[model samples]
Target chain A: MNEAGTTVIEARNLDLTFQTNDGPIHALKDVNLAINKGDFVSFIGPSGCGKTTFLRCIAALETPTGGALTVNGMTPDEARRSRAYGYVFQAAGLYPWRTIAKNIKLPLEIMGYSSAEQDERVNKVLELVDLAGFGGKFPWQLSGGMQQRASIARALAFDADILLMDEPFGALDEIVRDHLNEQLLALWARTEKTIGFVTHSIPEAVYLSTKIVVMSPRPGRITDVIDSPLPKERPLDIRDTPEFIEVAHRVREGLRAGHGDDV
Target chain B: MKQIIAVLTVIAALVVVWYAACIPMNIKGVLTEQERAGAEVQPPSAKDRRDLSEIGLALNNSFAIPATWEQDRPRLPAPHQVAIELWETTVQKKITSKRSLIYHGWVTLSATMLGFAIGTGLGILLAVGIVHSRVMDLSVMPWAIVSQTIPIIALAPMIIVVLYSVGIQGIIPKAIISAYLSFFPVVVGMVKGLRSPDAMQLDLLRTYNASRSQGFWKLRLPASMPYLFTSLKIGVAASLVGAIVGELPTGAVAGLGARLLAGSYYGQTVQIWSALFAAAILAACLVGLLGLIERAVLKRMGMAQ
Candidate 1:
């Protein structure tokens, strides 16, 4: 589980309630989690489970209304300002006006990286996403899967120590999603960066993570945290293993328990 | 090619309709002149020859219809007369001649171009303000609405008189009026464009910890291009209208509005129609230029098809 290092992200009794026009909607409540360095943790829950909200908190894109949340031993906002992590949103979110290379260069430009450095970083990240020769194409000119990879390249360009991915492969079909998952696992293995991935897919969660966090909605709270015993070097056939099946069954049970709590 | 053919067909139809309509409108002048000519022809009972039946007959009888088409001071001039007048003033006369439409058209074009620049600058500034600050959005938008509601015709003379009183004359007041007309569309379009980025795009910039100015430069401004050019086209046309209206009250000696006034005073229907056509042509060219610019810029940015 990569427990040899200090914690990268720590949450304690975190609460977030959005005051919408209808009323106060509880998004997260009494959530406690600790993610150590170089660990791949997946947050798996159904819709409205605040799994996305929790990822947003880590990126400081959303503020927690109560309790404490920390990234890299500092406030999430500070960590964000210091460029601690790269975030991949659900949609590619590439600026339509920019080519793939330029889109990846956005963060570098924002950070005032030199033109040469920006170019170097963009090339390296494009290679990382396996989109090496497609840098000159516009986002719309590329296939949807290619566009998503370009967005991942954009996030990875600045060489941050952590990557916060919000269901990046959720929109893809099974085949492309499987391909991306394998590539992501390979990328993670090479980088050894802390990753907090949010997803709704049980198989995806089981396949990708060293640790899995199952969350419940209607006042989102952590229902269970499973430390998978599956080997780190998992192939596509790992899902057939009895141990993998057992963990997947436990995750399915945790999800059912979450639905039962609300109904 | 199809578009050009379609446009030409529409224009040909319009000319045919115009020529037919002129026979009815100018029939009275022709009938009276025919009576003066002492031709022993029985005049159809056409409410003194300016009625529908007489016009229909005139359309059929080529011999009699020529007189109506050639009336000295007809209610409606024939399409050919207007065309002839336009050719003579624009092509036959020297450019600097008092009789030349070119001189007047140049004046109006100058004012339109000047006003468009001012309005574009003011619009972009106001749009930036509105997008960045809530107070500006609330305050400026209502005032912009009020400004438009106050009729340009009512506002033009007041602007002229005030500018004259302040020792400002000629093109500045006209440009100001044009600027006023053009500014609103720019403001509205630019605001929409600047805010065009979706929630996810904005959140992405925030994740990068980009400042507001960075957000504006990197995302908002570039996104607003298509909208800006569209508004600019509308604004430029409105500016031309403003410049012409500004010429109206002063009874200016130069400009297309002056030509319209002069033609009206002397019962020169053909001249007025010609001047109106010239103005319309000028407007088309301006908008066409904007379209060309839009294509080049959007294509460069990879935003064009």
Candidate 2:
């Protein structure tokens, strides 16, 4: 650790279980991870691999059945209460009735930001997302990619220091996903904010993240933690480089090993 | 242009058919039979008598082209006849004249509005309660559905009688009946609307740590607008039915239902028809007005235009 307080997210031996009609279902087991401040970390795993569950726990949406998880050095619940992070769901989740501007202002309004400041922030984020002229439009009128961009702008509007994104670009086509991944990288660089992204795509995880946390299913646990070799200045061409492919191959090997498949 | 021309052609064909049907091909006047019995009868002009009888029948039937086409058809009074009667009763003699439809219409409108407000309020409250509690969902929803199954016509008189015994009359009784009929749609619509938010959106709000009231105000209520407005349209129409049904009992002197009753008693078919038409028009207008408000509110919220 660089400093005692430098870690933005730290979870130690986290475990989660659910009660079912048949019996207890172990969802997560003995997962440990630490994310540094301003780091872009992506968690990649198969279905039921607890990637989303872990993200939820960090966001305080789910309680870990065992172990301790802290965000910004505070308990998940406290951090949630303090609004320490902005969460972006897999779906856009834009309120259909609210305009683009209003949707972006939702968190700001809830946090009681002054109208002028809210408008200022909203405008800035809208411009940042390249949706400045579409402020008056509703979410339903926008294309899927545009809606996702709006959702990102919404998260950015609150100016939160940490972002917990659960497959934010999972629903987009490959082209849109690639485009969004680059834009997200650019956004992360500009904001210098810590981000925890959950995705299943190996290449996507390898391309965007400074650190990759590969997880395994069946009592989900971290299988590998791969520090990316690529530089901070990532461009679209970086995806085609030998270094990017090597990281992606490592991630694939890690996933196969976790699944007990020959690699 | 094609549609308008087709409609005009159909209307003109109907008029010709009506004129042909009413030409009095078989003249059977009472005077004609008497003249045929050859007892040195001083005969009136047969053609003149037939013409006079046809004119009388045309006047009675209000010169409606459709009416003259079918002998056994229910009397389809022409638009002019109904209009003439409506003008004489409503405008010539004002509402106090006891024959005025305006007075009856006001009475019915009052009852309908009162009932509509009460029903809508009750529906919203029940919907909120149902949304908040599982017990209310299990208990109140089934009974609300059952309440609608009880015919309004059957319930109206009993409601009137019950209210009368409890020292309630006039608007209250009528309003209660209207509310009873109108509330179910609002409840159903509102419940569906309130629960409309998707899992992802709800999770987003939960992640934000928004309170229950904040979530409801920010998400649920706004999400339910389209459903609520659609239900209000149905509720308003139902309330109008309730008001009319309420008037059927107690023989109220100043309501459209009472006008219908009086028209039936005096065999003034045109009066009853006009009153019925007016009630329909009022209900349509009320629904239209609510639709207008729905559009305005939704537009302001940046929903669909």
Candidate 3:
């Protein structure tokens, strides 16, 4: 759906290994993927699968032991130096001592955004997340879902072209997770920002992603990349639609395939 | 409420018992062997002299009248005596006056604050080193633990002597001792706190192309605030201990420790008690102040109430 010709991130034959007491744990092996500009992609698999490792490799948090990984046509490290993406963790990870507004302002301050620009972006993103008036509230005072929303707002505030989320809604209850999934779909539809989301939930991956990359464990490697057939204009009611079910089924199949199950 | 009431009741009973125990129960202030030999020594007070006339009368009078009510037995120096002493030391005399509790308190306080600052700074640095490097962890962590095992009381005199040899007498030597004792908690707290971020969070930062320093400032340091504050409270208390210990060995002319020594030498029990109370109050105030700062910092970070 991304008409943009630019490939935002490209990983080719990427391999990553961690030296453990037992032996070297191969976290990733010969992984290849490309994310186009404004694309929404999800990496989904069972625990210890290469989904997280792949995500980390793309983020340049972990260096690939072999092969090349690039973001915005540059090395991950180069992209990082250029401040190319915004990241949201599984947990909200908001500083407890900070108000929502201050927490959002932290990256902005570090990245050297002017106060006025920081204020503008903070207000805009807070409004985008439906948390305009709740800026003064601490993360603990808010519900778990709200804290996650605040963190999302913090990522959005920077207005980066890419947003990297690692199971951002994993801790929320099903209802809240459903609500957040819908909100996330809407946000993606509006911003058209490139997203590489990591999740364990098939429904969540199918609901929000344009592309879902399924991975397997024990020397983590990608098994399949399933492109969703559902329409881009997603709504809360879309989850009940036949087309949505078809995509979810496909993601489930991809996950089963990744687990080395015939599907 | 019940706990508070029980504690108060216990304290009241203890006071009553203390008064009873101090009363002349047929024996008076450890009679000398010579006096016990029927030498007929003159009693120090007329009450004692009068009571000696009749054994039953003396015993009855001593038991019947409240020991505090009797002229001889000033039982616990009456609350007013302590109040008068406190007023004269803290209010009547200026804080800087040589005889003032505030003056001695300031000496202890200055050392505590200095030591706390040094300890906290050193602890943070050491924690960072340990967290970042396995070499430092293997090399420094064991020593840090070993350092704590050495009783501060045993080390205080050696610390003073070493500093004196280097021509570094006065506040610096005392402050160093305070810092030595105060840093351990901070190092431990900060190390735990700095590493508190989960794997996913670290990945999130990496995905953003954030460098190590960026990740630290943007993530680790902020995450460590709660831990740092908790350690600071502990560190402040330890710093006070260090400062007091520092005062003990050097024969410092001023400070709560010096006041204690002087009071003990002259048998001014009340002065020693007052000085001990003053030191406790100073430590409490310092810790309370650090707590206030912690609250403010945390609130600013969107963490605390």
Candidate with the greatest TM-score versus the true structure:
1
Better of 1 and 3 by DockQ: 1
- Candidate 3, residues B21-109, lDDT tens digits: the string is 44444234323222455444445444565546434433534433343323322323434445567778999998878899989988988
User: In CAPRI terms, where does candidate 3 land?
Assistant: acceptable
lDDT of 3 by residue, A1-263 (tens): 34785788998898899988999999998988888887789998888887877776776777889999889888887877787778888888887767899889877877789999988988999988879899888888899999999999988877578898989999999999998888888788788899999999888888888888888887688888888887888877888999889878877876786777432
Query: What are the lDDT scores of the predictions, listed in order?
Result: 0.91, 0.84, 0.81
Candidate 3 A-chain TM-score: 0.95
lDDT of 2 at B89: 68
Evaluate every candidate with DockQ and list the scores: 0.83, 0.68, 0.48
Q: For residues B3-37, what per-residue lDDT tens digits would candidate 1 score against the true structure?
A: 99999999999989988888877766676677677
RMSD of 3: 5.4
DockQ top scorer: 1
Given candidate 1, what's the lDDT at residue A8?
Answer: 92
Alpha-carbon runs more than 4 Å astray in model 1: A1-3, A261-263, B1-5, B41-63
Better of 2 and 3 by lDDT: 2
**C-alpha lDDT (0 to 100) for residue B103 of candidate 3:** 92
lDDT of 1 by residue, A67-128 (tens): 99999889999999999999999999898899999999999999999999999998888888
